[model samples]
Each structure stands twice: as structure tokens, then as C-alpha cells.
Target: MTTIALSQEQQLALSNLCTNIQLWAKELGFQQIGISDADLSSETERLQQWLGKGYHGSMQWLEDRKKMRLNPELLHPGTRRIISVRMDYLPEGSQQIAILKSPEKAYVSRYALGRDYHKLMRKRLALIAEKIKQDAQAFIPELEISSRPFVDSAPVLERPIAEKAGLGWIGKHTLIINQHAGSWFFLGEIYTSLPLPVTEVITENKCGDCEACLKVCPTAAFPRPYELDARRCISYLTIENKGEIPEEFRTVMGNRVFGCDDCQAICPWNKYAKPTCEADFQPRHGLENSDLLTLFMWDEQTFLKNTEGSAIRRIGYELWQRNLAVGLGNAPANPDIVSALTSRLPQASELVAKHIQWALVQQKNPNRKRVRKLSRTRV
Candidate 1:
């Protein structure tokens, strides 16, 4: 697409529109919003290096979309700027450390405790995009405008975009961390044709000398600062990996049945993390602090009903059961857990059956020890 030079009047109107969009975004429940130029040349080398290291594991899509991810214009034609927004997702009264310490409790990732964010975020972003289109049309008639909203559903490099838009700096754990807001939030973007003035101020990396996130990982998923080997990551092991739970990481997996939050929880900046006010993000079905056996006992129908409209539903019942079995194995072996595992063994698929049997062995073995100490729990 050819770039059209905007007159002074058109430039002023676009600047005002950008300002209005921020206010509108706030009204739409976004805590922060920023505009960034579409150029992602700086991130290309880093992304290539990360992909080359085989850090993405089974997530081959990340490698597949390398070209589009580097060039926003390719992903969405006529895109000149990216409007980045952040929505805090940490629910109030989260017992992250408490539930993590209690081996009997099933520790679902705080993000998955509530309804899925994709639909909600996409709807909100689309609304913002429409409002932008309306305002742009009103300002300059016949000015071509095109925008596309993206949550995590697309190949968008949301964090890098957010960072360029002055949202936050990328921390050692590779998550965007605001100095004040921390990292307990979700990011979304609207790729737009409008040449809005980009955010001039970029937040510098504030994670100086703090290797807490790296050291606190149960599976030591981080090989170095700003690098993650997702294959060994608990979140990947529990949620992304389709087959059996790898035996190597199970002992250290603890009670986290869905996803792990150790890196975010251990970040010192999270002390300032704000709890989300959105009802959609609040925990559903008492998942905030459920017991291992209670979740493990959930039949396919029960799992389906409970996880409806929740991110956990994407994993399906088999992977859900497989993860719970690992959690049960990590729990202080009780007869109830043993019974739950034993009863499910016959009906489980070959993949899930292996995990169930592993749980049984863990339940029966009195000498099997937890790899990590429980005293490090913090939120």
C-alpha cells in the first residue's frame, strides 16, 4: 500500500483521534493503551534466535508465522500502527501461594480460573476498532481505514508490540512487566492503517539483578535470562503437550493441574500487581482453590460443564485428566487419590492411562519425595 502524506489538518485530526481512542479504551475496561509504528525490525533477530534454539517445543506455529510476525503489514495489509492494550487479569483474593503450598489443592493457572479471555478481549478490541473507524470517517471523508483486532488467537507478537507502544518492558522471564502494574495482565492489539503518532517513550528493562523468576521455576524451564525452553516448562507440559506427562518434570510439577505461575508469582514487581475488576475474569466453579482429588474425580461431562467458555476447555478431557493425575501424584499420596487413579485406569486412553498408572505408583510409594521445597511459595 502506498503511503499518503497527511496535510497539517489531517495530522491534527488523527492525533486527536488517537487521544480519543485512549479514553474510549479506558471506558472499554482496558487499563492501558498505546500506539506503535508497525516496524518490528528490532525484534526479528531475537525472535529468530529464540526459534533457532528450539525453545518453542511442539508449538510449531510460532516458527511457521515468522515472516508475518516480523512484518505487521504482511499480517494485516495497510497496517501502519499497532494499538496495544493491557487488561489486568489477576482476580481479587487470589490464594496463589496458599494453594501452591497445599499439595492437596489443585493449582490451576490464575488466568484459566475464569472465563476464557480470547472472546472477551476480541469483542472489546473489535468495538474499539469500529469506534476508531467511525471517528476517522467523520474527521476525513473518503480516507481509507482498515483495522483488525487480535487477541492471542493470531500470530501477533503482542508483548513486543505492547513494549514498543510503551506498555511495559520485557522482563527476564520474557513477560511484559510494568514498573507499577507488574505482569499480571493480558495483552491485545489492533493493527490499523492510521498513521497515529507512536509512543515516543519506551519503558526500559527494570529487571536488574533479579533472577528470581529463573530460579523459582519448578522445572528450571529458563536456561538463561530472557530465554525459556518451553518443552520443559510446566505450563507447556500440562497444557500444550498432547501425550503423556513427561516423567522427568512430574515430581516437581506439584499440584499445578492446568498451568504454572511460579515465574509471575515470584516477580518482586508483582507486589504492585492490581487485581482485575472484570467479572468475566473472576474464578468460576470454585476453581480458585479446588482439591486435587475433587478435580481428578470430575468425569468428562463434569469437566465439560465446568470448563465451558473457560480456557481449560481447549485442553479437552483427556489432557485435563492427564494433568490432574500428575497433580495427584505430586500430592501427599492418600488412599482417596489412589482410588481415583485406579478407578479411571480402565476407561483412560493409552496416553492418559500411563499418567494414571504413574499416579498410582506415586501414591503407593512412601519414599517418593517432592523435588522442590514448599517454603519458597510467594505471591
Candidate 2:
């Protein structure tokens, strides 16, 4: 962590490099890029408070990486600045609300419908880092450059860093929301030792007086305006939780089999969300508008092959089936759905079998009401 002294001319050159980095990032398909100092002291107390609340659920990794998350230098020594970038992920013709209202259909989170963003983003960030390294070396040939690229794979406090980088502000739902781009985007970062000039203009939080995201949450995950109770979050239950989904959340989970998007979907700013130009993010395997029964019928091999390179693959077949079972249960009961759930009961894992049994009960009970209110036709 030794400080490298630079002359005034060298500092000006480094600042100019920052401008070139932004242009290079755009060439690499990033929608926006900004620079921020690697000081996260402002967020340390907030992280501790969130962890103290035990809101992280079974994700023990968050706790394990708390120190590094708050201090980038601890995670990557010599890190002096962070290059934050955002890439739009929303696909065109996303039938988000349509699929949600159609109980028979499965509502995979839009972000997971395509290839996993980690690899794509990481590769792009690495290239950006390499370009920066080359440029910095050209500016100061004797200067040693150190940089690391990160997607969601690392315990990086990306949302807060992006905010400080002037990318966007953390919305009420705890996701970064750009005034123009909304929240349908993925964030990536490059931790670098180079003395790049940081962005001075921090994006202001524009979510004033709008509680639409909080109210639309099926699980009421937000206990307040800015805090989230991950234990009660449908996204965490469906994607991160390794065991059975709690009975309380099962019925209200609706047809969202992968991750929930109610908060972002209801946010008014999303009207400005432009469709992603990246082909890698386009929905694959018809997952954007798939049926619960259709996905439920995917055997382990089929599931693996279909979800290859996709984010949904990480959940594995058991959780995949388990999530679809919950979705099917919330669906309007159909003879086909009932038969499908009953047939899978014998082969299902102990965890999935229990969910299938619960789904069977829900399918048979005619008095059960759909938890989701159908109105909008897109997210």
C-alpha cells in the first residue's frame, strides 16, 4: 500500500486517462462507466447494521467477506480507485407481467433468462483493465499497474461503489437505479492502483415519495424505505435458500420460479429502461415466456443442457424443480399441472417432494386465491 508520488503533469495525464477509459468502456459495450475512490468508510456502519439484523439469511459468504467488501484495499492490495460500469440487461418484448398473470406460465427473473452476466461482464472488464494498464504504462513507463475485475462473483459492494462513482443512486428497493436507464442493468468494476480522477458528480436519489416498489413486493421484503429483509425476500428464497421455502411465502410466491422482479417492475422510472443491445443478454430457451409445467417437465439432463452458461444453472436441478413446484402451486389448478406434480413426487428429492406435495394441495384446493394482482402486462 505504498503511496506513489506523482508530479502535477503526471496527475493531469492520469486524469486524461480516465476520460479515455470511459470511451474504451463504451466501445466494449458498457452503457456507462465512472471512477470512484476506494474509500467505503461511509458504508461500513450500514453493512454492520444489515448483518446484525441477520437479514442475509443462509448466505454466509456475505458475512465472511464483510471486511473486504467495505475496504477494497483489503481485498486487493494497492487498490486506489474503482472503475464502475453498468450494462443494460433487459431484453426486448419482455412479457414479464403477462407471464406473471398467466399462472400456468413460469416467471423467471429477467436477469437470469439469458446467459450468466458474470462471465460476459468479467471478460469485458478485464479487457478494459488491460487497456487502462497499457495506457497508464504509456503515460508513466516506470509506474507499476495493478488492477482486478469483478462482477457479482466477488464480495464487492458494487451498488454503493456504483453510487459513489456517479453511476446511479441506490433506490428504495436497494437496487441501483439510473434516472435514464432504470434498474435493468448489471454492474461490474475494476479495482486499480492507478491514480485516476474520480467522478465528482454523484447521482442524486430520485425515488422521492414513490413507494410503488415497496408495496408491489409479494413478500413485503422491504421493512423500510432503504433496508431489505433478505430472509423474507422471494428472490433469496427461490435462488439463494438451499432448503424448503417457508410455507408462509409459498402461496404468495406466484409463478416467479427463479427470481422476483416486482420491485423493479413496478418502479415508474423503468419506463425509460431501454432494451439491451447486447445479444448475450437476450432471453434463451424461451425462458422469458415459459410455462411452469413446461419447465417442470425438464429432466436433470435437459435442465443442465438448457441452462448451460445461464445463471439459472447455479441453482441446480433440485432447486429449479423446487421453485417451479411453488409456481405451479400458485397457478390456477389444472388437471395437467396436478398430474405433473403427482408424477414427479416419486422421483423428486426429499426437499422437492415436499414442495410437490404442497403444490398438490394448492392445486386441489379450489378456494385458494392468486396472490398477485394482474394489471400491468410488462415489467
Which 10 consecutive residues of model 2 have the lowest summed lDDT? 370-379
Q: What does the lDDT read for residue 161 in candidate 1?
A: 92
Per-residue lDDT for 1-379 in model 1, tens only? Answer: 7778778998899989888998999999999999998999998999999899998998999999989999998999999999999999999989899999999999999999899999999999999999999988876676699999999988898888999899999898989999889999999999999788887785889899999998888887877888888988889998888877778788889998889999999999999999999999999999998998988888999999999999999999999988988888888868888888889999999998999888899989999876883222221
TM-scores for all predictions: 0.97, 0.97
lDDT of 2 by residue, 224-326 (tens): 8889889988899999999999998888888889999999998999999999998989999999888889999999999999999999999999999999999
Off by over 4 Å in 1: 373-379
* Alpha-carbon deviation at 1 in model 1, angstroms: 2.4
lDDT to native, each model: 0.90, 0.90
CA RMSD of all predictions: 2.7, 3.1
